[model samples]
Target: MPVAAFAVVAGVIGAGPVIAAVQGDPALPERTAGQLLADAAQASRSGLKPMSGTVMQTASFGLPGLPEVQGGMGGASPTALLVGSHELKVWYGGESKLRLALPGRMSETDLIVNGDQVWLWESEANKATRVKVDAGAHEKAGGHPKPEEALPTAVTPQQLAQQVLQAAEADTVVSVTNTERVADRAAYQLVLAPKDASSLVKEVKLALDGETFVPLRIQVYAKSSAEPAFEVGFTSVTFSPPAAENFTFTPPAGAKVEEKSLGTLVGEHGADRGEGADPTHGRFEDGELKGKIRTVGDGWTTVAVLPVSERDLRTPDTGGQRGQDAGAIADTILKSAKPISGAWGSGKVIQTKLVSALLTDDGRLLVGAVTPEKLAEAAGRK
Candidate 1:
């Protein structure tokens, strides 16, 4: 297995255009649901080179407790960057060569990943962090593979499609509902609807390219909502490989430099993947969520529970210290979390469109792509 190279380029997942049910052209070969998924997985992994596109994302969790996010979200991580619009020019030249140009007030923040050398040049801060990409990709055959470097737990449409197809088949009703276009490329809309009514997610729709079978776009809709609560896709794309210069960058003179390995740079997030069916575990180095991690169930309806310790909650990792006041940050998030109690006991709940988590006062976190009831049930269990 190779290290996934996809990063959170421009985090703004929004409701995409309505994919209408239409007849597929009779001229085109028909594919069964199983066949389409198998082919898509294979195609997404092959011949990915020299591609450039506009990455647009609009996100709205509709959670009241989220600070700085009143209506919607756009950027990545932390609540502060949520609720806005951001567009980034992304270039992908295989897994070793990748680039993202984010415009800023003074200059621009560019992330360049060329081979083992990865550089993040932030013009505003005049800082550059150069690091070696992680070595998670030692193939059994020999040497390293060209697969992308994994970022802080963020997922791409193609990656999500593969994960869902592999792990969520039994838990969801999979179907091809509509034929649509993304970034001017014709695509098939594969819809995955959860069979479990206790899950909050209404459905996950993936638009796979007609020819390549690569997932061009993925949209997740909350239960009862026609529009997607989170979506990401290429607004405009070119299959031709980007120029070599795109993946190379040089920081300005006098810029402060802080270098760390990709693992160190991502803190604990590099290993924490919290998708519904995907199993993941890690200590909360970021002080957001930490504890003895474990999954409660399997498949799309699966839930995860982590027992938070008093020490982990109190400690925050600031650059200098173990971190800023970890305790303070946890306290802030806990304060905002809505309070609730039931047979499963009492806890504060952070409800978002894509995921929901239950934080008990007793220091337990139960999270998943499930409803409150599902989390509560998991919580009540010994």
Candidate 2:
């Protein structure tokens, strides 16, 4: 997980946007915080009816002095979300199998819930577990179980209104800007700022549909920061009932069963699937190979090749130790291995197991290797 975090950081830093679109007028008129919140809450409740649609989710992390890190895990490559009473479903590929929150536990693996019982399946672990949920358990897990931790962060139209109203009650002003188009529907822009600076959320902005009152966009800003730390934009949505099987869960035959907390599973899986830093670039020199490199996984070494405009990195003839002299091939491999920053410290270091040079689909040269401690550091009982 730590290695993945580092790689994500590198990716985010490498990608940055210079311009941002203005959705609502900042000088829009103000309304009583209560009225705005009430309207928002009402809209949320009414829109909660059985519905199904696609939803896309992405998470980005930013730190001081470093570039931002962004990653997305969703069933819809770019979008997926479903709404319904009998069955609700959402999927984010590569991030998690499926998620279900029942009373007292949250499962990010595959899950199926029927009235009083919930079934969970973990394909990677080849295990299926069942649990009975009651009213008490629901309350303990926060009224209702959600698939992912990010779900709670999303505010429905009604929830947005209620939150705006609550902020108003606290003497915070709620301002509703002019209606604007989002996903082809007119939406009311609402902004709420706290009267005190010590509040958990400094400010929240929401875009609610004019007719359905569904939330189209949400932005959250930190107390002392000017930029939004988190943002969710709905590209598409629907209000149709989901399929009956959407909520059904059945374990495959011969699967193992066990009792465990959701937190335990998340911690365990996160470490196992975590990524590492980006590889450094280098080349062969003299009888040795030298270049920038980073350690990943357990005993895995990764080398990044600098983009060369004149050279094609993907030719098969470029690889294979058989063609090159032993000394030249060894030197080429060693020369390409350079130290990577922030991948190691006094207590941790990356080790290489094997090295393979290949070309990416886009014709870029890539070297894949294993790190020794990478897996050990990321895998353990939560």
lDDT scores of the candidates, listed in order: 0.59, 0.38
Candidate 1, which segments miss by more than 4 Å at Cα? 1-29, 65-77, 81-83, 114-118, 127-170, 248-291, 309-332, 336-338
TM-score of candidate 1 against the unseen true structure = 0.69
Tens digits of lDDT, candidate 2, 1-382: 1112222221211121111123445333344433444454454334344443433333322221222222112111111111111112342221212334211123234565555555666554567767544557546767632222211233563454343233233324345565566656566665655444223345556666555555666665655456654555555555455556666666768888876555565544432221111211123322123443333321112234333211222221222321122223233333443433222221112222222333222223333322323222222201
Best by TM-score: 1
TM-score, candidate number 2: 0.39
lDDT of 2 at 31: 40
Candidate 1, residues 167-252, lDDT tens digits: the string is 43344565564458789887776665666688788877677677766566777799856677877777888878898988887766
RMSD of each: 8.1, 17.5
In model 2, the Cα lDDT at residue 342 comes to: 24
Off-target runs (Cα >4 Å) in candidate 2 are: 1-35, 44-47, 54-61, 64-108, 134-174, 181-185, 193-203, 222-227, 258-382
